[model samples]
Target: MTASPSSAYPYRLRLPGPITIPERIRQATARSIVNHRGPEMRVILEEIQQWIKPLFGTTAPVLTFGSSGTGVMEASLANVLAPGEKVLALVHGQFGERYAQIARALGAEVDVIESEWGWTPDPAVIAAKLDKNDYRALVAVHNESSTGAVTDLAAIGALLRDRDTLLLVDSVSGLGGLELRQDEWGVDIIVTGSQKALMCPPGLGFASVSEKARKVIERDDRCARFYLDMRKALAVVDKHETAFTCPVSLLFGVHEALTMIHEEGLPQVFARHKRLSDAMRAGCVALGLPAFGDQATASHTVVVASVPEPLTGGAIVKHMYETYNTAIAGARNKLTGRVIRIGTMGLISEADVLTDLYFLERSLTALGHAVPTPGCGVAAAVASLS
Candidate 1:
């Protein structure tokens, strides 16, 4: 299924920003599908896995699955954790809360360290919890997309270095968009999806497992879910492949995307995301909207902003879509109707930033909401970047 540029809303400003498929990926997919278990496919899978390791800053094997980000989340729990094991689950937003639910459903004893939706959990608090508990694993969402907050994985890793706790991280939105040092941070299992900063369509899930986690899983005799077993997945990886049918299209896209990322240089890619995020936040602040996440814990991909009392987030979104032809994400759950999320990852540019700010101001004014001026947001963004 090729995406047509013309099919996109002509005048609509895409707030979520669209996925970018490089020419190489298109050509790769154009090749006839081969047997996934064959040697040729095995070589491709190995190369993809090798390419993914550096992106996660880990030398460990990265397991690829034909599933969504949630699949990896489920796999992490089912494979490494046995029923009745104790886990420290940190909850700062919707994604973090998911770990708590998944862990509980797996019959694990879950101890949660809850923080406000828009704030990050203090590393000290995480350390305190680890100090008192003999938990089997510590689970955290490195970047909470729902709240646009980034947890300090390095600090959390430091806290767990002295302990026997396995650090499991959900970095679905954090991996390629920000600076993530998985091996350096001592993360045991790190998970990510293709749809975020990887610049690919959704459906591919990835996880890099540490040697320590591998040993623990190897020692456990419990049977994991057939489809989500990490041990079986690793066994296949040893043969340079997956246990089940993989999403060939998405894999093709990932392979191409990684090449594009390499060509651009990882440091430059990260800087681009950071610059776009800063521009978006500065634009919002200039328009009188407050950024939702704590400045210190802000993510480079998405920026959550509180809508003014008189101007609802929905109204802003609607105006941007109908009038300006721009799309933006709304708040999730408790934050619904209260916040607007602007994404700054994958194929976004300086022009996109300025255009978004311009339309945002116009949309607010058209909806009878207060905004500073026509170019105030753009000006503020420029000044912030300077």
Candidate 2:
């Protein structure tokens, strides 16, 4: 039987009430909606573009859409590759497969390098595939959420540096939470959403395009879908606006979130995320749970752990939520009922990690599963930090 949703504890740690709105932006947005094509709206649009560049580690114009990250993912393919153009895709988990699917749906020839779900794709494997095919682009996920794997972007970028292939990345879960340098890595197109590391409620999607990717968009023989067309987005953004009505509330939320990130400093924020991730992994190890991903390929945002046979991942998640009010992600696809995912991104803290450990241990015991001492996970996390 499935656990009841009402009995779920939501989250053990209280997240700050909906992101705090900056008084100035709130007051400005609270005024009646501005004309979408007016000069005043242009200023707001330009400010948003300028603000987004730094977060992405790029000086290029960043495009915004009032849609999910999937929108940008589709846009990246639609704008760059023509029908039947070849692409070498690297698949480490579900997101990678999604990229391949999107490219194929757009009529691009997709040559995929499939890796074990919980492991990073080997660069050598990708290089071998590239050697055989003259693909116009290569797609990879910076962070694989389903399997909790982190691909080495720098290595992958280096491999594609001299090739004509555009290095497209799905950084939805990695942006701001992990180290990503769009310019330095030679990435042609990078897509991210507002919810994860940006610490804003969902609704906004962002993409950073390189000169190479832009050129491909111009040269592609096939016309892109009007709404998902990147060329159109770029044209409007060049005038400091969007091709369609924007998500004003979410844009305001992004402005506030970006301000907070800048104030905290990007490097410091990255360090905090890394520290939290390391601590969470340590906590998992301390609890006698083996991490699902190979140690060398673990993602910073989510940690996947193998649960004992009788307990099941669902039961563990249910117990943690119902008994401790802590919400955690569960395994997906083939990993269902096998692994539990603990996400330590955005505003999560070390104290939250310790608390999760305490509850996880208690919940396991309550479920008639044996676990180590209460602070074992906490100590492991601290040791990893040290």
Candidate 3:
């Protein structure tokens, strides 16, 4: 079982989504709801389009939804796949499997290139599969939150540069934190949520569609969908309106979040996530908790580390919450008692990373797991940051 947040009013949310929101963003959400189709809403929508495009690395239309990341994931597939259409899914972790499952549920004949939980799918292996099959599209996850493993989208994108097969990417935990050049990478569709590195709440999903994907969306009527229909969303967004009544207050928060992202500049945001991830990994290793995945391909958004023997991941997670009032994450599926996840995305700072490491070292010690040296974890993290 995971650590319960039942004891506190505001335990530091160190999860992939629903992360700690900054005061400006929280205040943005508290603003009164506006008319979803009014002039003010139009202006907000226009501004969001202007700001969010660079984050997706796309100049194409980026659609918004009144749903979570999964909704846009579904939308990306729905707009392109037809009944019994063959699709290739590169599965490394849970979220990658979820994307494939969504395709299967849509009646597509889903084929998967499965990799171990802690590793990402090899681009060469993916190329071999592409050579063997005439898939309608290839599905991939930009960052797998479950295992904290990041797939090399740029490499995968290069593999499909001249192919007819579309590349649909699930960038849920990656967009604002990692490097993504959607158009340059030749990705057809890119899906993400506002809750992750975007530093907003969980009610909004965004998708950037390339001209090729838009052409498929415009021509395909096989997948029956209403709320997730990209055609309708595209038509209205061009008018600076929504196809349906959007979550007005949540969009307000998203607007504020995007404003902040632009102000800091995307390069600096990516650099910050890199620094924090490096620090977290260094600190964990110093505490005898090495990273769970391959270091070369590990995620910079969420850091996954192994828990030493005789100490359960859940125990340390619970201890962190109960003892320090801070929340970390436990593993899923096969990794369940062995690993802990630390989120280093939006609104998280160096101080937060150091404090988390300090408390984590204490928690491990309190749970009867000995560290190499007292204060060494924080010291290693500080050194990494420098």
Candidate 4:
């Protein structure tokens, strides 16, 4: 009999993520299953709790759940902000809107400050709004992956300082790849996933809650959610445990990934991302392709460039996969057919970026799309490493 389809390697990917995983992390996660509540699991959870705090830059309570980043989005609004309270959602792209949606669904009155599709939220705009109104909390996405822009967190955070209002951030794609200081930045709640910068498969959602946010969670009696309740989770965490069945394998992967990040040193990791991002954009410039958003606010974790005339992003995505054995992403939601995206996170090396660009140049040329400047794309990209 022929081999099963699952037996073969799927797409050869250079995704905007769930990107490639490292060998060491894969090996660590492959161990035989262990009892979720046993002593073995206890050791793992405790270790993760201590280690993950540094990444978050939080001395506050950092919690892990076996759900996606959206889960924490729900938990944050549901547990802390009471019904009928007002929340200001600063939205630039898709993920920022997601924060507002979750808050609205959970009964908080959402006041949204929206910008153009490819523009990041102006901290000045948000600050002006704050001065005129009283809000229970401010919700923002640290990185807007869909439009490839990053919000100004430092400016936003500074505005909220020492105030009654709390700050919630979705750092789903930024946490492990970018520099985020939870406590220093005065971010009350920060959430992320294992799939993005952490260099692991999707399954784990990590969040950090400040003492001020925890008190709000503790006192909210009107809406009692058991499964995703921060207080309930924290009680068990006190014993280094989970309130529900956890993904044991994913926990292992997260631990190893975090260990690898610290070993490399965060400063080095950050510098590497900056280099790769600059190179990717330079390549885009060389190819005469416009990136989706403003360069000033572009994300360090993702790059989105406009597809030239005579081809949609989806078509190019397909062509690149079939003809070149690579997989980058096409646009999603409102931006579909307009732009192509590349992930610059989680084990994607400078060399990998170069290889992807080389093939990208070839694929675009194969599609009858002329390279604006022959060899310019690769040259500018390669120079960024030096």
- How accurate locally, in lDDT, is each candidate? 0.83, 0.80, 0.90, 0.84
- Cα-lDDT of candidate 3: 0.90
- Each candidate structure's TM-score, on Cα atoms with residue i matched to residue i, is 0.93, 0.90, 0.96, 0.94
Residue ranges of candidate 2 with Cα displaced over 4 Å: 1-34, 38-40, 382-386
Model 4 residue 215 CA deviation in Å: 0.9
The residue-by-residue lDDT of candidate 2 on 17-89, one tens digit each, is: 1222334545544556667778867877787787778767788879988777888898888888888999888
lDDT by residue (212-313, candidate 3, tens digit) is 888889985659988899999999888998899899998999999989988898899999999999999999999999888778888889999998789999
Q: Write the per-residue lDDT of candidate 4 for residues 1-386, one digit (tens) a residue.
A: 32232223354567777888899999989988899999999999998888788878888778888888898888878888778889999888888889999988878888999999788777788889998888889999988888888877888889999788899999999988888888888899999988999988898898799988887888856365988888888778879898899999999998899899889998898888878988998887787677777888888888889877777888778777777667788977887898888899877788778877887888788888888777878998988666
What lDDT would candidate 2 get against the real structure?
0.80
1-386: candidate 1 lDDT, tens digit per residue: 32233334455434443344445766766667777788878878878887788889999989988888888998888877778989899899989999889988888999999999989888888877777879888999998988999998898888888777889999988888888888899898999898888878778899999998898877665435888788778888978889889887677778878888888899999999998899999999989999996888888988888987877887777767766556787865888888998878876788888878887888777888777676889999988777
| Candidates, ranked, lDDT | 3, 4, 1, 2
Best model per TM-score: 3
Strongest candidate by lDDT: 3
- What root-mean-square deviation over C-alphas does model 3 reach? 1.7
Give, for candidate 4, the lowest lDDT window spanning 10 residues.
1-10
- Winner on lDDT between 2 and 3 is 3
Between prediction 1 and prediction 3, which has the larger TM-score? 3
User: RMSD for each model, in Å, please?
Assistant: 3.3, 3.2, 1.7, 3.0
